[model samples]
Target: MIIYKEIEISIHNSIYVATKGLNYYLDKEVRVIIGNQQESDYVDVIKYIIDYIVENKPIVSKNQNIGYYSWLLQFRLEDINYYDLYEVKTDGTEFIKGCDTAISIIREQSEICSYYKLHPQFPSFNQMVVISKGVYEGKDIEAIRYESPEHMSGWWLITDDYDDDIKSLMTVHFHHVAFNRPDILKYLALPFGYRFLIDNNVIHVSKDDI
Candidate 1:
């Protein structure tokens, strides 16, 4: 059995929650930037988040940049603006050489480590509502790209038509999709304002009509 411990570290006025035992699992460590040094009460939250990620082994995609992968957390935590995650190299103790977000220690490019970054905005789910469904057949899963104000924009999976209410739609957060219908989670990282059609649980890219 593998066991891991989450530890708190401060560097350059930033507070990070990192793992001590994950190296055994992924040959690297996972570090999360909760907030600046002054933030508090994130230990338990970090522990829970890391545990969930390790246990579920959710889908991870490469970031637009090299040496990084998108490891997004499904649920939102209080006072945490960024839920996005990434992994980088480390000496197993210090931040990667020369880069001092102070996040990790640089190893050969092949080694893996984890970290987090901020997106322009995370879907607030408050102003988000599923506008329609049954837009696609055989899929039973209608996918909608949410285009709204900051913190309220991202992809929306419309599995059913729910009278267009925010409360009901909000319940369809990442967890639901990641758990019950993870086949569509691959589209989570797609850019905003792009609609996709699913046929028999398979995704195909189609040209947008001008």
Candidate 2:
């Protein structure tokens, strides 16, 4: 059996070293939270969430910086032959039908992890929710090009302009700002050097810190 403890150090170190720069640009009050959703027992559920986001998020098209949302349903419904999950007719259909399937799977997994005998040692469902919502919110931000940085780009969003209701619902959400490039995984794994700042700090605290 793969033990989480063995890999935790590497994961944590990678995250810290990757995102250290971006964290400097964020507000001092903003906090960072990192959870190993991909390492948990319910890895399938996490993969489903990633697939859902990939299928739904706006894709850059040739004509426009932002792709047409018209093709969203069609794209989502298209047969996803990329993974074994799609082997089961129910799998692809569930996500394609509506957001309900995605939500249900997440909820079920959350409950399973929550009530497991080793709950205290396992990652919490709330962490998954926080990360998911944060990623969704981050994707909505507009990408800005940086000339001096030699092809580097970044995403920026003003907190004040965000919908109050939506912002309220995202109480545990964290900010993510990184360039889209070959290093996308490095960025997504730990955007803005958030992990570094958290690690270097004497005491780290966030809305969800416990």
Candidate 3:
């Protein structure tokens, strides 16, 4: 599924407009244009594009026609009182083909930021643990307990309720961490309140909060 970030719409003229954003999944720019002489209201157009994006979640290819179903837009515009508008047109030079199966639009900050931030070469770490297990390498492991300076309690525990997709994503995320930040993994089995600082080829841990 493609997630678009920082999507914005702009008007070129009374009958020409476009929407643009970065496709988070592919790390590529995406733009879609619309043309209709009778449709000049930006608000209506913006709403239509928003609904289209949320429902279709389009993904794009380098060599593909960027055409969305005209009938779908027509059906949607009817609700906004599109009584005098012409038949929608998105083809040839008017369209910028390449969107498919884009499931969401993430504006501004995101859950984990850029996909490149998750790249193995980067110096980063997961801010929080979403899932944890009670055993590691067939040995029962005690939970690591830590409290932030803000007084929020944190710990890890075994969970089996995550769906398949979540499990797969988590597996990939951990593998990425393991590849570049193996040091973090070694400390994963460490005892409670073991805060560790990670830098390039550096490791520091504090036994007490300071």
Candidate 4:
């Protein structure tokens, strides 16, 4: 009955076997039903997204907007074969969402044109969204939708759209998270979308509750 930041539950026989530590349970043979709200996913992806989360890794969207706003990127991360919405600035040559630990930048093209011609931040250029599945080297990777679409779609339009084709980098700062994130998700979805459950206090959850 020790207090844990997160709990890993295997729902095979309603046994609900409780386990501690994110990494320990992730590699185990369990379905992984994390119930710590925000702490669960955090602990789960720490090894893949935080400790090893590097920016500006060259990712090519095999095709444009394949399905539900995700691309088939050539991301070179093996852990990403699962779910995780990561928003990387297409231009690795510059700072994305103000992140600094960028290793190598792909600088994927310059045309990130989008349909933001109405908002105050209209005439924007470039785009970044939570990627689902993508191929690394020669495979398929999926971008996770941590929250509902309505909750996360807003960040898809906050790109630098001032520069022309020659210089698509918008001079105006269009970063969504300038003050959040120990994880790369802060750059992809709205603050409320990803951080909603981080501070939640759900003591227990039942099938009817879901």
Candidate 5:
């Protein structure tokens, strides 16, 4: 008698499903499941599995064509600015911690903002913690502002308070501006936020995982 086995693995919070056949054939799929109900939620998962089989599970080429897939992912993630964090750091110790914390908070907020379509009138703010060795030479850091299509604006600004022998700087950026529609600004901001998270290493996944 011949038997088949199916296996599942979770990597970086994403899931992969694989199958091994009695005849030595193998199959696998990578996918993201949004909700708990229905097998239709597994459509992308299944398609990926089929493609994997057809392509013989080749490693993704660095130059492989992503095209619209890239855009689609960007569209879902939102707008984010990494320069804002870099501009505020005064030293290495403070820079590392502050950057990490900021990235984490921004990732959380981005998801909330994306889900709720956070209103521009109600802006969000958070402090970045820093631990550094260099003297924090207090200097005014200029703001980099971004305007989204939804008529929303984001402003990253440094604080007036400075710690001598500067290790880190505390800065705040607000992502909110009243857009014409309720969720327009939030949607526009997701890609920016996603990019920021990626650049800062706040969230990570293999190219094959996505």
Candidate 6:
């Protein structure tokens, strides 16, 4: 078992110092569920991803430049404006997916990560949802992209303007973004200075280890 993980940087092997953000969440675990019907519901893990990324993005190492991963996703609300109204929903501890804003980002990031075969610098669901050319659960779920202007501050809408609901399990399917599975996400490594940090899950290094 791993204790409080005291920045143990071994010189024998390539290792780097872990950041405070990665250190604190080492013991915690997060899970996400997608799609639902009847009441038209879907677990909003986007909010959770966004919040975690934003809070930790700054403390992360200099190599992990996650600035392009927009912290604040601006959107319209069917003509309604909620100036500073923030998300209040919760997924146990992190912010729940209010709508498609976060998911859209997730989809986009997943595509890029898949293309490059790399993981994100922040903790997120490593899953994929492609456009279903076939019909699912009686509805033509083309994979809701959450491209609407309305923002649900308290809860996430089940079916986005384009996506489908999980009325049944066989209705649709999702590809898990398990970049590093079988092992805890926090256990992933990253590069720091001339060395590499052991078990740096979120922050990924893009260049060669020098």
Predicted model with the maximum lDDT: 1
Top-down lDDT ranking: 1, 3, 5, 6, 4, 2
| Candidate 4 residue lDDT tens string, 85-123 | 223444322322211122111011111111211111111
Model 3: runs farther than 4 Å from truth?
Answer: 1-6, 13-15, 25-36, 39-49, 62-210
lDDT of 1: 0.38
lDDT of 5 by residue, 30-92 (tens): 223333323332333333333443456444321122111101110111112111111112221
Candidate scoring better on lDDT of 5 and 6: 5
How close is each model in CA RMSD to the real structure?
16.1, 20.4, 17.9, 18.3, 17.2, 19.3
Q: Provide the lDDT at 24 for model 1.
A: 44
Local distance difference test values of all predictions, in order: 0.38, 0.23, 0.32, 0.24, 0.27, 0.26
RMSD of candidate 6 to the truth, in angstroms, is 19.3
> Which candidate has the top score in TM-score?
1
TM-score sort, best first: 1, 3, 6, 5, 2, 4
Poorest lDDT segment (10 consecutive residues) of candidate 6: 79-88
State which candidate, 3 or 5, has the greater TM-score.
3
Cα error, candidate 4, residue 39 (Å): 18
Clashes of each: 11, 4, 9, 12, 23, 12
Q: Per-residue lDDT tens digits of candidate 2, residues 22-93? A: 112221111112233333323333233233434554332211211111011112212122111111112223
Q: Which residue window of length 10 is worst by lDDT in model 2? A: 65-74
Model 3, position 181: C-alpha lDDT score: 31
Off by over 4 Å in 2: 1-95, 117-210
